[model samples]
Target: MTRRIRPRPRPKPHPHPLQLYSLRDICTIRILRFASSPELLEQYTNASGGLRTGMLMEHLDSLAGSIAYKYMLGPEVETLGRVQERGFYIVTASVERLDMLAPLYPVRDIRLSGQVICTGKSSMEVAVKMEALNPNRREETLMLGRFSMVCRNASTHKAHPVNLLIINTREEKVLFKMGESARNRRKYAALHSLSRVPPSSTEAAELHSTYLKYGQDDESLALGDRVWMGDTLLEKTMLMFPQERNIHQKVFGVYTYQLGFANSCLFTRSHVSFLSLDGIAFRQPVPIGSILRLRSQIIHTSPPGQLPAAVHVRVQASVVDVQTGQEEPTNDFRFTWTRDDGQTVPRIVVPRTYQEAMLWLEGQRALKMGTQIRGSRLQGRDR
Candidate 1:
């Protein structure tokens, strides 16, 4: 009998310069060399209670803005006016947790990296990936989402043709194929409109009343800041409510996400495209009695308009403990404002307009789906 030895395969080289590097490498380079770095945790080091979710969402939005400007736009697109010259852009964003770590540190951090995956006559597809990066934990994949944006000529204000490029990888090719499916493709497009509820709905009307009652003249108004270019203000508050637990008194993910979405909308200027979001993370579980202080800051802005030349503003929120003044950021989100033109604007008289109403409905629907699955599992166990 004869024994044979096989040689190990050589490492393959990336085809392009961009392929050689990755989102992590880009984040590291930006951290070390760029003047604007990811918002440090030091700011919300002591915030607690309801404020934690708000602050985390704000941080996520800021992260999205930084990455979008750095990679997507050119140097010419610097001012608020330039950003507006682009079309109606929305920040379709979400957050996911990686692990259970101490309240003081991030179990995992999120990074938004998007590339032009494909193009059509008037629109383009951007494949965005969120990666988990922690100081002391193993790497993990959080989630993946795709965004479809249409670019137009700034002068004509009409949809223009894009020079669609061919994808280079087999994986990307497959994703593009899945995206091309009429049913799946429609799902992505319809999400924007489907997430909205009618302005006349009972819930929409209730939320409107709630906004007028509580958001109009509270001390929380003092903390408000200009997060956008046009006539818009951003106000935030962090508070707590009681909840039931199953042996372990843990805060619910649905509640946390809903809170994050609500706060993001609180200061958001209605009638604008919510373009892009980034750097969202869920670190520690918000426990009962934990006073969460949501500290939010308005960092950047773009032009405001409805003719595709709409401005986008970026905000970041971090959560901290009010009693001990220790921050345990549980979420980070981003929001954008798009002015309404004849074809794009929302018809509403109050703060809780039709668009806002629809958004709340869609959010509730998503939350219910998660709860239903959990309830089903619980029932199965009991049976």
Candidate 2:
């Protein structure tokens, strides 16, 4: 018998301009051309060495916003006419699965890219990746994350329907499925979150034990084994301005994130390293000229002997009216940080109020989820 030879599969051709307007049309990527500089790092960093997590998050939100815009309005809407006529505004609904793979150094330029992987009625899941580019070596991935964005009617300020995403290739289809899985997980977590409902038997037992240990007598609390919920709080206010507005004339979501993260960092009271940020939900858009107040509280802290002491901080951003002094919630941010030093600190968070107790439970849930995800990823890498 003669030996048979098989031909290799040919590469798929790039789609034409007209064919690109379908569901796959919204799939897009963007690159930031600037490199990290000392001056730039100075603005974002604390007394620490390099860039802060807040700065990176700010950049990530901006990049995700750009990708979402292109995804919704198509590439042709680069001009103001198309934007005003048919374009709708997009807001960051939530950020999930933010994994900081490596530390970003100031000597390297950071390259950020993302694409719309999946879509719902009015929401799109944008998966973003950040890499550090060096002059003589390959790029190093710094972080990977997903941002959930919702389209809103320009006039009504309500969620509006968005274009459906088209998955053309098998790889694209796989990504779309993964995005869908993430969305479902988020919904499930939200539904079953301890903060959203009453505690279970085990959790109730734990709470009761904590109360008995700390609430029964003043002497037990005076042992200094626990930290008051009020002790690890930081608050600040800023005036929203037109300079920070998006196309919809509202304050930029990333600007609010920046403020929240900075305040959360201040609440840590130590050299902190970014671990993860979860469930950043935007409830309402901040109007221009409004006073935006961010209240950050450290709700949970790891006990001593846990190598890098983990800290959970929750930041609530609310808008205060100038004349009436009415305050309305605008957004909620949850950030996880670890002490940069390996010093062991016995920091126990004691919640004194019902609201504080709820926040503490929420923090516990967030930390548990983050740890599980991180562990699974690491195990996969090992395999």
TM-score of each: 0.35, 0.83
User: So what's the TM-score on candidate 1?
Assistant: 0.35
User: What are the clash counts of all predictions, listed in order?
Assistant: 47, 2
Q: Which ten residues in a row have the lowest lDDT in candidate 1?
A: 26-35
Candidate 2 structure quality by residue, lDDT tens digits, 38-137: 6665665555567666667777887788888777657665643444355357788888768776776766677787888888888988998888888887
Q: In model 2, where do residues sit more than 4 Å from their true spots?
A: 1-46, 76-82, 135-137, 155-159, 218-220, 253-269, 379-383
Query: Which digits, one per residue and each the tens of the lDDT, describe model 1 over residues 254-304?
Result: 333333344333434443322223223344445656555443322222212
- Which candidate's lDDT is highest? 2
Model 1 residue 57 lDDT score: 35
